[model samples]
Target: MKSDSTVLPDVFRICFEHYNTAKNLPTGKIKNPNEILREFDFEIKKNPADAAELFKDMQLYLKLTPNTLTPNFQNQLFSGLNQYALAGDWLTSVTNTTMATFEVSPMGTLVEKKLIEHMNRLVGWENGDGTMATGGSNANMISLLVARNKMFPEIKKEGQLNKRLIIFVSEDAHYSFEKAANILGIGLDQVKKIKTNPNGEMEPSHLEEMARVSLSEGEYPFFVAATAGTTVLGSFDPIDRIHEISKKFNLWLHVDGAWGGSVLLSSRHRHHLKGIENVDSMTWDTHKMIGTGLMSSFFLTKHNGILRSSHNHGGEDYIFHESEIAEWDSGPSSLQCGRRSDALKVWLTWRSLGDLGIEIQIDNLFTMAIKAKEMILEYKELELMYEPSSLNICFRYRSVSDVNTLNKKIRHRLLEEGNFFINIATRKKETFFRLIIVHPDLNETHLYKLFSDIIRLGNKIKEETEFCMVKT
Candidate 1:
């Protein structure tokens, strides 16, 4: 039997081998719940498992999981992995420290602070403040909370009471905003969806009209969230135009840049967020675009001390003590008590790539997006649902009748085949494939293969359906 120390090293080696070979393998194998339950032994027994059994379990776990690093993986908003970021994540797990206090996590605290400063500068906020969130959703929720507290300070102590607070967001905005409103005591009905134009950009005129209506109806209009990149269409709301309306109504403006914030690094693409600096707050998820490890999200604001004012409460006597370094403590400004050291991975990734390297990466992705659009147009069978705006490319296979059902069947067959991993989305009652191009390894070859497979599968399914109908 191998010693415990030796076993861990061996396991690490196995994991490294798996990681290196994943790109060459199929993206994933689709397994239903019953198939998985029968294939793997998941029972936690009365006694501790032996080393050999544990090792086998680890191997099985790796084998069963989907390979997100492969170019075929265009499923979610994020794909691939940054090697430097992975190293930082490993170090964080080994150290195992919370970011609640500077005393316990000194290096972590400074790294997080410096990273926030650099990100804020990119957003054109010279002296802004921010903190790492669990994910983009959490950061967005925090934005709502901070905006609410700052606008209605009395609500913190006195509670919402009879106050009917209203929030305005584009109809194409992330669903997280609706969840945040519910979590923050703002009723779902109070979330007014502003009308969007044909291109999916928010109509500024409709926003102002709604704000006026809210005020007249005795509802307190507070926050307006503009999406930097909408989920399905990847549309960026006209931030400059929206800001004018926010100012007129004294509404807190927040840009949800979770999927598109990294565009700020690209000089050419930064125009998407033209009036970002003027916004009251913003949510950025580096993990989505930069390919950092999961959960590298930041909630940034121009107002430096608002986070402390909004979230700080209790913990003074026990964890927070009076000291020179007390100001460095992140607990006061955070919604969590035991936050993980998420900034180290992001900081390390930035340092390894530098601003110029990341800029080039973003620029290259935009170019690739254009290539994808061109390819979609080249094929007669494949139809482009919307023009390429950012990384997301929404398209579907053309069919004579029952186009929606045929496309859905094509996607389902593609997943079962396990050669590719992409996603399907519906916009305006029409279904299409939402291909997210974030992985560095993705190229023209992968895109060609994906479309070829989709077309081939679509033709086969259609022919089979026709044959069955003729036989009947």
Candidate 2:
């Protein structure tokens, strides 16, 4: 057995070693459940394990897990870790306090309040209110709940009655909206999907037409969500145009900017979210683009105190005490009672980078996106699927036949090889590679190598298929 003082230092040393060598590690190694179970000792016993045994287990865990910190990782929207944010996360764990009450977590409560204030300013809101959510999905759900409660105040206490409530979102909006609809007691079928343009942006005219039809059919259209940076093509819905329809139909307008909200940091690219201030509420995920740790999501609204009005109930007699700073308590506004302190990491990251540094990082990513598009164009075999509106670049290799199948195979091979980690998306029944350029270390050299490998793998697969057919 080792003392706590000695154990802490030894564990930290192991963590440091793993962190320093993460870049050299393979992005991931494919393994099935059976394979992993066979390889690792993941059993519990009545007896306590030795400290040395636990240390070895920790090392094994790090070795087997995918290294998202490396440049080779581009499989998801988020990649790479901010050192300051990491430090903040460590500190948050060391403190181990709940954000339920201001008294217990005074600094944390203030940090969240200040971060929301800064984000509100970016969105052009003067007297706005917000709360850190579990994730973007949670934030989006909160938006729906608040909108529903505001429009039909009776529903909160009296329950959803005979009224057939409806909500509208672009066809390309994240599926989380539908999930939110389900969770918020709004039936899934009641969620309407407005048609989008060829570029994947919401068609404002179509939105108006649908609202009119819904009104004529005696359905109450209460919410219209405009997507800022859709999931697949990364398209920004015309917020200004959509706002007109929302106002005309008396609908609560919410922008699901979970994927692209960070663009507000960049002066040159902030135009993507034009007219954002007019929206009633928004969902922003700092973890996606800002590289903060996971779950740094905010559900912000221009309407002051709406969050508390919607979510606060039955907590005053207990956790929420009567004090001057009781108004600053975050539990009353949040959906969860025992909320983890998620604000510190985002605050630390933002402070370390400052607004200018963040803006430069965003601008540089856009530049990298353009470079990726150009590089794809230069390749004779590669075909661009859609002109990228943001950081997500969709393209695929050309095959004489079964192009979609070939592209899927190439992606699988890339994953199996563990040389490059990327993703593929299917739209309109056509599958293609969806290269997310998010990691700061991702550059021209990495792009060139990825393309070369993709082309090589595509050609190899095609040749193998032809040979098999000839043999048959």
Best by lDDT: 1
lDDT tens digits, residues 74-111, model 1?
99999888888888898898889999999999999999
Task: Give the per-residue lDDT digits (tens) of candidate 2, residues 230-277.
Answer: 889999999998988888999999999998999999989999999999
Cα TM-score per model: 0.98, 0.98
Off by over 4 Å in 1: 1-3
Candidate 1 displacement at residue 91 in angstroms:
0.3
lDDT of each: 0.91, 0.90
Cα deviation at 16, candidate 1, in Å, is 1.3
